[model samples]
Target: MNNDEIKAALTSKSRSAKLERRGKIISFLCIALIVIAVFAIFAFVAVRGIATFVGTKVTLWNFLSKTAWAPGTTDASGVPKLGALPMITGSFGVTLLSALLATPFAIGAAVYMTEISPKWGEKILQPVIDLLVGIPSVVYGFIGLSVVVPFIRNTFGGTGFGILAGTFVLFVMILPTVTSMTISALKAVPRRYREASLALGATRWQTIYKVVLRSATPGILTGIVFGMARAFGEALAVQMVIGNAALMPKNLISPASTLTSVLTSGIGNTVMGSLENNALWTLALLLLLMSLAFNLLVRWIGNKGAMK
Candidate 1:
């Protein structure tokens, strides 16, 4: 109403507007930086990956189909045998086996933590499980090399370093990830769902199986997919136990190699601009693509579950 009051109100309004504009600019700059970084990484990998084929006579079919992967050797006719099917199969075989072994146990533990032993889990078990995630991968590799390898060799026979060893180690590494995610997902389900099931005379077990788990399917699947992704890309522990043999896996107990193992092992052996080096780049590109595909699959599963 007075001139002094009018001036005070005008000053307050001006300060608020300036603060809002500054916040918006900061947020936009953060988002733009993230976009630039992601695109830069993709461009770098793409150029290096495609450069492998430049001036080389290898076909995509030969690279993917032939099982022999002798990057440093030539045939009797002096042609390099760059077939990658063995490594591809080894990667998928170990990853899938580890996932199969881990999923049911992870889900069951998640259910018990969230539904059955909420009090103890909240106070003790959950923190202990979360702590497992921070332990270095090399520590797990050491334990497997010392303890599991000898056990497998004594029990089953053969050099203990094989697919079975790799699977068991990866299974342990992925458990914490799957269990934490599943617990969070199960906990996200509305409490009313359980109450309504109980009102209908359903037992606690039936309510969990039919109502809680059904509603939390998306989260559970997302956790499993994430664990699989980690297993797929794992290099150190698997490489330590998998024997590093660049051949098709004959059986679960046979020595084998995965894509990551080959890359780490072969990178130092090849010259910078040689075909072998380029082929390794191609394998790196394939790994990146596989990770992207897993992410897309997770999004699709989540959207489908949300719709239901």
Candidate 2:
């Protein structure tokens, strides 16, 4: 090649390499910032949470197992009542109930979309599900407060703010999430699997039950876990409907409170360094841990499915 041409080619290569390196550096910096922010938050919450136990010398057993939760007041023994059992039970109650109520409907909708009527499901239901997912949490809370709460109060013979109301609201909110994930799972099944099942003299329903759903079981479970996590972490909606009373849930219609609801309600009322504040931070740490556990469960399910 001529001198001019060779020099031009070399210059172009050098510029391209510089741009690539710049892009890599930018991407790496962005990732690093995200990692640092996550760790910072975890560390801050942990320090504040542990301070409650460290400063007050509250036994972990009493904090987790006792029922009284008057963080601002001390009993006759001169110890703060920081029990979190009521909130823990309430959180689990709503999460499990809502997930159970939503799962069947989600699976049915997903089956219809992926197997029964793909054309109609794609054209109509997909947009509807997308719309549901996009609606804000506040709107859902308002609707629950206005509609579901009143209906329960009138029909169920109680004040209406309770676990049952929270369950209904959460059921609706998580339905779209579980449905979308199930659809993706069902669609991921190889077309050959369906064909082979059919060729083996299986009916469509049998094929779906024995093959498609069986294969998608792990994905469906992951979706349900995600839904449960969403329900567990929900604050404002549950707060509006759950009566805000930190008591053990007596029944579905009894007034109660979850960890998120209690945190949202009381966090602003306490001083920054008070026992009340530290107790709230501990609740926040518990929420973080539960979310982490849900993610780990999802990963385990995925790995098991892969191995199978």
- Top-TM-score structure, candidate number: 2
lDDT of 1 by residue, 1-308 (tens): 99999998877757678899999999999999999998988787777777766776667787888788887777776657888898899899888988899989888888888899988867777787878898899999899999888989999999998899999999999999988888989999999999999999999999999999999989988998999999999998889999999888888778999999999988899888788888898888889889999999999998998888
Q: Give the per-residue Cα lDDT of candidate 1 at 69.
A: 87
| Model 1 lDDT at residue 205 | 98
How far residue 177's Cα lies from its native spot in candidate 1, in Å, is: 0.7
List TM-scores for all candidates, in order.
Answer: 0.92, 0.95
Candidate 1 lDDT at 164 equals 94
lDDT of 1: 0.88
lDDT of 2 at 51: 82
Expressed as tens digits, the lDDT of each residue in 1-308 for candidate 2 is 99999998877757678899999999999999999999999999999988889958587788899899888788889889899999999999999999999999999999999999999878889998999899899999999999999999999988998999999999999999999999999999999999999999999999999999999999999999999999999999889999989988889899999999999999999999888899999999999999999999999999999999
Question: Runs in model 1 with CA error above 4 Å?
Answer: 1-13, 76-79
